[model samples]
Target: MRITRYIVITLAAATFLTGQGMHRETAERMKDRGLSTLDSYEMLKELTGTIGHRLSGSDGYEKAVLWSQRRLKEAGADSVWTEPVMVPRWVRGPVEKAFARSGGKNHELTVCALGGTVGTEKKGVTGRVIEVRSFDDVRALGESAKGAVLFFNRPFDRTRVNTGEAYGGAVNQRGSGAIEAAKVGAVGVIVRSMTNAMDDEPHTGAMRYDSAVPKIPAAAVSTMDAEMLSALLKKDPGTTVTIQLSAQSHPDVLSSNVIGEIRGSEFPEQIVLVGGHLDSWDKGTGAHDDGSGVAQSIEVIKLMKALGLRPKRTIRVVLFANEENGLKGALAYASRDANVRERHIAAIESDAGGFLPRGFGISADSIKFGKLTQYASLLDVVGAGKITAGGGGADIGPLKPFGTALIGLSPESQRYFDYHHSNHDTIDKVHPRELELGAIAMAILSWAIAQDGL
Candidate 1:
């Protein structure tokens, strides 16, 4: 009996080692193909240069949908299609002007209207500028805030090494500043742009107003201008700023989530999902924001096809719509009826900028995380071996309820916020080699999950 047990144990150990060796070999091949071809960068250049920014419900978005479908087909997806989603339509009209008058001098304040802000009249609104650090400060002024341009001048926290954390620490002022200011009868609000960089380029992002309060126009002042305005307010207590915005919110428009898949050889019903949002803010071409992610997601399909590495479970790539202003596409994809028949074992998202690959952030239980870390050896060659906790994208958040394991590709994030939601986020900012490394990392992890279910 002891001899038989030893024989069984030895066979099991050998089998495990053989599987690990094969996976390493496959990862090496993927790295070779990804580095030699640099297909992801070429695809990103075409998408960003040809289609430009794909804000939800715009002609550019529709063009991107068609382009994604064609690219997926070209990449050898067995099936490709679109799912309908209705998205909010907000346009930044031709006029968005702001200036501060202090000490009898007019200083132009670089600004852009936040998405979904109400437009000011043709004459514009001028009011005494009252700079406040937080909502508490706005309330403290009470009646003083009435008819004042409540400037939320909270600067992005620069101490945090993770720029995303720094953005999170300060972005609340931008998202809800208008509602809080309007509640106190403020006429308009000017938020400091959400970036650690002290540049003159204004960044625009989404903001909201409570229906109970009067709607007020909102804009983001450039970080440098925010500092200047703050200094002027200290020097001259009674500084007035004039702002005009022609931003308008129209009816919701129809859009679609682009999807393509390679069917599993064994468990076709089970899926390993990979995705990124297709929509972006209109300030720039969105090359880094999510264009890199979209290209990488599609390139997963290409890489698998090129190497002829078929998995035991399906690999689906979804380019989500309306992620900039809303997650309607994500919500639609995760709806009960849409997912009743499908079983998604895991979902990976690549929304971070096209920077150098560091590792992955995982949202999973300790058991699954431990299992995932076992594959770290395969990824260490590409410099993406680290796996941390609590990571997922806004588009993939909805899938959590379905017991699907969530993974986010974490790139080096120091420079991401400098160009985020601004005109600086352009194609030239991305490097070809860095972009391909990210794709290679994603492909290796995806293949591991598909081949050995977790």
Candidate 2:
């Protein structure tokens, strides 16, 4: 009886080892296949080149929805569908112009209107620019800021090693500057573009207003222009600037989130999701901001099909809508009924960019993270084995309450900010090999989680 018990225990150990070995081998094959084919890059080129930018409520976004459905079907998704979502419709009208007049000279400045901000009057708004590093600085001046252009000139903290951290440190000025400046009776708001690169290209992003205070036009000036404006202010405090923006916000419109899935062979009810926001800021083609992410999400389905790897849990790909200015698509998906929510065991989002592949960032408890680390060895081949805590995508953030294990694909981020929300974010910036490697990493992780729960 003792010998029989020992044999049973030894066989169980052997089975577990064999299963892990198979996962490792599968990961290697996925890497080789992905690197050789470079399918993700091709898909991205087609999407960006054909669809252009896919800002919510735009014609391009509508075309992208149809394009996504077709591509997912081609990628061998067992089922594909769209979920309805209502999104804000904002238009950056025909013109956006700005210039500074000081020191007896006119300096042309590159600028773009912040999304959802009110437009300037037909003649535009001209005011003596008062540069402030923070909202506190505006309040310190009391009524002095009234009728002036409040310039939020807080630049990205260059000292921070991580560019994302630097962006976070300074981004508040762009998002809330209008409301804060309005409180001080400011006529307009000019914010420094949120990027580390010292370029003349303005970066546009979402901004909001307070119903209590009057709404005002908000725009982002290039980093170089911000520097110039600051110097002009220091030299001559009476320096004035003129800003003209035709941007306008319209009524909400109907949209949808594109979804496709590969059914699990065993645990069909359980699910693992791969996703990225489909809507991008209208400035550029959005190659890096989330175009790469969308391509990578769909590539996971393609890779699994090509390798004939049938996961034990369903693998779904979601291309979220309106992530640029709003999170309506994310909210709509997360608000599904309890039965649908409980089936989601894990979700992975690749919204960072198409940069070189790094490890994933996980947002889960210690027990689940430990279980997840068991598959880290399989990811080493692609150099995505490094895993940290506290990470998820903006689109998948709502799933946290349901206890979904959220994962974010953390690619190298140094260059992402340079192009984010600017015209520089084009497909040419993304490396084909790097993009494919990211997809390979996601595929391997999804498969591992599908085979073994959590």
Candidate 3:
């Protein structure tokens, strides 16, 4: 909680004198390096191209742990380690199919199984289809939904400027639609894709079941398919469909949180942590959702080493596991050892896509947060240098109770959902210059926090 780092840095910043002047000088050097550097871009390509999707408890995820551990050391982190964590494994079996038939016409819907959903028998579950706009509609139907396939066809609010906000408005149906439908004895549940884009690509995300409800099958229908089904339902009230989801859950698997740090020259125990989830959904390589974050976190240390600016506090970067389906990794890291959490001054996470850097979301008290605004403004050269209110990330949420200053790197949100959790979230979607800018933004802020106590 001491912030003499920013206070001292801001005073000598204009004059660029000594002490904190060295911090500014080194940050300027990092800025120049970021502009010309292809490291971030190249690193992301290697991960997405090679490792591909790394879902929690999958073989890909285990490989990602080893890959990240080696890469962290190769990036010149002073020390690297992994903490064991057990994560639930959800596997998508082969051939997921969902199709509707009405008035002798057939509509083959593009669909993928929602994470953590149970699989139907070999032939699949076919029954009368019930279309509902929201959970209220399902409740209204009440017992009428018994033994029927309930489709939650809520569309993202395209009117919202922030697509993330639009996704938030509609995603609850995807996350909780099954639980509600199950209460009404629904045998199957379908949710619309959580994206503003009206496309055939079905987005898959995490969904959980309330222990009291019987586990049932769930799938995400593409936005276009959702609209098609809705229209068809109106045309023929008794339209029916067969959903054959081959997904199943198995025993939990052992996973690891990839962690590394640059030991501080001064307060080595005080830590400023930066990270993103290493595990992604089992779709197209998760370049935007988190491959970008993993590479960017490691890139921060690389940039720091290149600049030769030793921090006053330990700079730790953790590539957490199981963020997509479960928070086991985040919780594990936060509770790993009491002593570690006690020394954690701040934790920053970059999980937003590798879009243009907008600004950072700072979460701290007025006094401590004010220091961040001043120290963080040094990133103004890159558009992502501003400081805003209300920030933290899912992977870092567990650290709040320990008095850790939680921060989230905000990026342009216009197109993030377009590729999120879908096949479009590939490495090709990431722009090199934009990715580097995000890495630079995090590096500058991390340096600021690492320069002293947070």
Candidate 4:
């Protein structure tokens, strides 16, 4: 499973096209065919408005699985089915908010409880708010944070080239802040929404607690609200904030990963995988978070079949479930028997917001990726020419240990944070042309990999 083997295989397979003098014509044909079939607007509408939020273990997740199966089958994919996976179901109950009095005026703030957070007693918990920028600062406060609500006001660094990287740097606070704060006796936690843009929308995401640490209720405050709270706390350290969140977690439930495949005529046993998570957060419609990815993956299969492009390797599209609350769908799919794992050659995931595709983040070696770069000219027409050497989306990360060449589709991240995990991630936020360009980029890559046998 060394990465170099994939490169050798791809180069060997592609030699046939070049030797036969069909490379140029094939490229041109694919370019023409892909542009004709790529339609982002219709796909986004179908996924966001029609399918809506697809949280795993919920009814919406099941419906999305069925929708994917029907669409793939209608697209002339050879096979379509579901793979069972166990997923977590955390329900956001009646979440309400109140704030401490400052000069007799109550400042009402916007907030959403974090996923996997424990609910307060029916009466709720209220405590003085303490703001900290980083985990180190929280540790510095120590006992000072006791009986207080720890507010993480760190903002995404917009100066980074890739917004995803900026999100990665700042996300540890959101994911582990509660657990860290609880160690010293903090009663509750409030994280600044992970976005570069200043807005009132509070983003929600999953948080984890250490086994030994006490689990406390955690929520996210909008970036602007976080600033307001921080400013208030500076002036009046004793300012108390009252939070009432009725959110609760249900027992784990059975769910599934929807899969569809266009079997390769030459090498049905070898596979190239393309996918996106089917699950989304409860807020908004989850349109940009992953609805765009699911549609684009399906569109790849549709375009391939319509163009009469029979790949050398089986191209599979899997819509994973529970990517928001847990990675159950990815884990279950990866845990398949050894024989099934052996056939998988590559897995590409597109969970980034559905914006104009800038390039692909590849996690393979130079040689394998160099061979992949052969399609650079083909993708340039669709504006996905920037291919870097490092990446894989969360849903496909598990496949890497099994020697699968993993990739993440990189889209324009400028506005991704604006809607991610917020109420703004609705169908309207996504541009039709940008979504279509992403679909075309994915289709081109999938087609090239399938034909090249990797």
Candidate 5:
């Protein structure tokens, strides 16, 4: 329920491996408690079902903050509190419509505006649409794209084994499609949704403009709509589209980060943090994008309390705000105290989703990495102990620069992109059992770190 970091080492116990074997004992016991008695399903159900969409600067996010404070106390946290944060506010207007004319016919396309984008005026923008596969294609277009609506139709790379990698490859267009389009005097821009699944659902995410260049309206078209648009353009090169988006950005709004903790009996000052973002895009309930992580992070505290497993170091749970479009919450938490960098040892975040766990991505030097790999054995029975090379989530990403060891929970990624940032990301999409497995793994790791430390 809290976010912070600390590092503690008893040179006598951790000579390259402080309390190594001892940490495993507590870790194995936690795994047992997790598989047999722990349950985070109902909490997740209530979260996604009742709390609904928790977009930053929205009422839902405030309700989530209060719920987290109350739930953490009810779950028997030693202390729970909130830290103030300022977040940007973007309003999606009522009028969002687009139509393409080709072959003497008009076709309507499914679409949504990306976050942080500038909206069109009362009449909106219309121009001859030109399709491009990548930024390279945009560069090739040169002045040809001027005054046209740039349509970025790059699909996710199916060849990449890791779907996350595929998303990374295709995400830049959505992040800055409008900026690039405006560079060529384009009136507007349309990007293809970022998912492997081909469907009519349009996925929306954060986008930004460079003040140096003129700002333009931008939106995402569904994968299926993008395909159709591409085919239509091939048939008739002069096809044009009329795009409208009422979305607009307002001033900064006040928000807070929710934090709760189970005090360490031996060393209350030291901390081991686990967290997830509390905010999501406005389209869906945010079940997978981070609701799963928020539920499980709280469940991590609850599970530890239920088992009465007191670690030597404090276990803190944090629910960060504004991770969808900005790292404001993460940066705020990182700057909350000068000692955060000094007192916090390990920060683990679960933002990937609440699906089945495959392993953890541990970001640290060789000594710490080796120790975690050995401790990962505690997860062998549940099959989530594979430790790979990686760091923490976006909310906890800044902590890495302050000398804090960061870890991220990795889960099955093949299906995650299908529902992410779309209306399809509802409660029913999450499997109860798979969600618990992630918490179980996180709990074991947290307890192990508290028992010894990173």
Candidate 6:
């Protein structure tokens, strides 16, 4: 009788464990069904190819707003509308270049005018080039510089683990080279493109003139051309270069932050935000830089609606404008009334290029992050299980003051810098499948958060 009782107890315990395993399998299967039904490819195609590059205050950006509103409405989202915001309107005017001649031969170089730079009075500026590798070198040449164009030929350090770090290292030169050059009476400034690869495509970014220093024309030369110009200058110190930039900043313009929301069934007041900048540098089609992110954000809503999944928390999709030259859209959204700000629970941004979905970089405390990782199995289906805490996109950075948990999508970084801020950041650079995978991962994560109330 004792032996029989022991056998019965062991069997009962095994049966209970088996039943729990089945229940867990059933739950996973339901989650997988939800994930598999989401069509990420079609959504990406409609956004990237249909909308193209959506620079802030440009026609593309406006059209994208309309497209998002219409699509969100069609996707059964509760509401979609535009929020008023002032945006910068900087035009990339005609860029012309002629190399300084020293040996009686003209060396032609490629260049693009930096955003917000003043056009060289119709005829343009011609002067001898003064090359400097670092900001200290420019400081050392203070006062002695007069009517000379300061050339910032700092190359991006390729050894950095994060290419974004390399870009940060070199971007200061482009952003403030004109102002620094003007401090010492320099007529203009030419900065080397912030790129790791040696190419002939000039990267254009926002450059600000210090209110104290006189404003002057500024542009970025391709890395290849910068190197060639440097080598030529070494041989001939008396080389003269002529730069003609037509780019100019127009008056502040009326723009908007496009917002669409799928009202939650239970917690309609609580909100979860997902977004990306709807702007790009005026060079190539801003496909990878942010077009991918914009499209992916939109698709998250579309996919959730198509799957007929009603999340418990309000899911708001925002397509921010002016993230390239300025963060006017992001700022406008963050500066809302206190009542509205208090309702925001979390925000996720995907400004990282449309590369493969490697994982998500979260910016939340241990408790919140621990809860987020519980859904890791659901996210792993879409290839985004690698969740590390600590990182937020620039557009979403301002929301931190509100105590909102910020999260940024982290994709494979192997080739993001290859086309970032370059003319090569076109639609062709992005793989459709990879782009869809990213959107799907975002949708799944957002859905899980909404349902689980994280």
Clash count, one per candidate: 0, 0, 0, 0, 13, 1
Measured with C-alpha atoms, the lDDT of residue 221 in candidate 4 is: 88
lDDT for 335 in candidate 4 is 81
C-alpha lDDT of all candidate models, in order: 0.92, 0.91, 0.88, 0.81, 0.85, 0.78
Please list the Cα RMSD from the true structure of every candidate, rounded to 1 decimal place.
2.0, 2.4, 3.3, 3.8, 5.3, 5.8
lDDT by residue (tens digit), candidate 1, 166-271: 8889998989999999999889999999999999999998899899999999999999999999999999988999999999999999999999999999998899
Q: What's the TM-score of every candidate structure?
A: 0.96, 0.96, 0.94, 0.93, 0.93, 0.89
Identify the candidate with maximal TM-score.
1
For candidate 3, the 10 contiguous residues with the lowest summed lDDT are 14-23
- Model 5 lowest lDDT segment of ten: 1-10
**Residue-wise lDDT of candidate 5 within 23-55, one digit each (tens)?**
556666666666675457777778778889888
Compared with the true structure, the alpha-carbon lDDT of candidate 3 equals 0.88
Task: Give the 10-residue window scoring lowest on summed lDDT in candidate 6.
Answer: 22-31
For candidate 6, write residues 1-454 as lDDT tens digits. 9999999989966764564354344334434543464344455456657766666677877877787777767766778888889988887766656466767788887888887888887777878888998879888997767889889998878888777778889899999899888888999888998788788888877888889988899888888889988988999888878888777778888988888888889998788899888778766778887878877887777776765667788899988888988899889888888436346777889888888887888888787887666656666776678888798798888888777778889898867777877778887788877877788777777766776565
Predicted candidate 4 versus true structure: per-residue lDDT over 101-186, tens digit per residue: 55456787788988888888876778888878898999998888889888888888878977888999899998999999999899
Stronger candidate by lDDT (3 vs 5): 3
- Compare the candidates by lDDT and give the number of the best one: 1
Model 6 clash pairs? Answer: 100-240
Ranking by TM-score: 1, 2, 3, 5, 4, 6
lDDT of 3 by residue, 162-267 (tens): 6877888999988898999999999999899999888999999998899999988999999899999998999999899899987889999888999999998888
Better of 1 and 3 by lDDT: 1
As for lDDT, the candidate ahead, 5 or 6, is 5
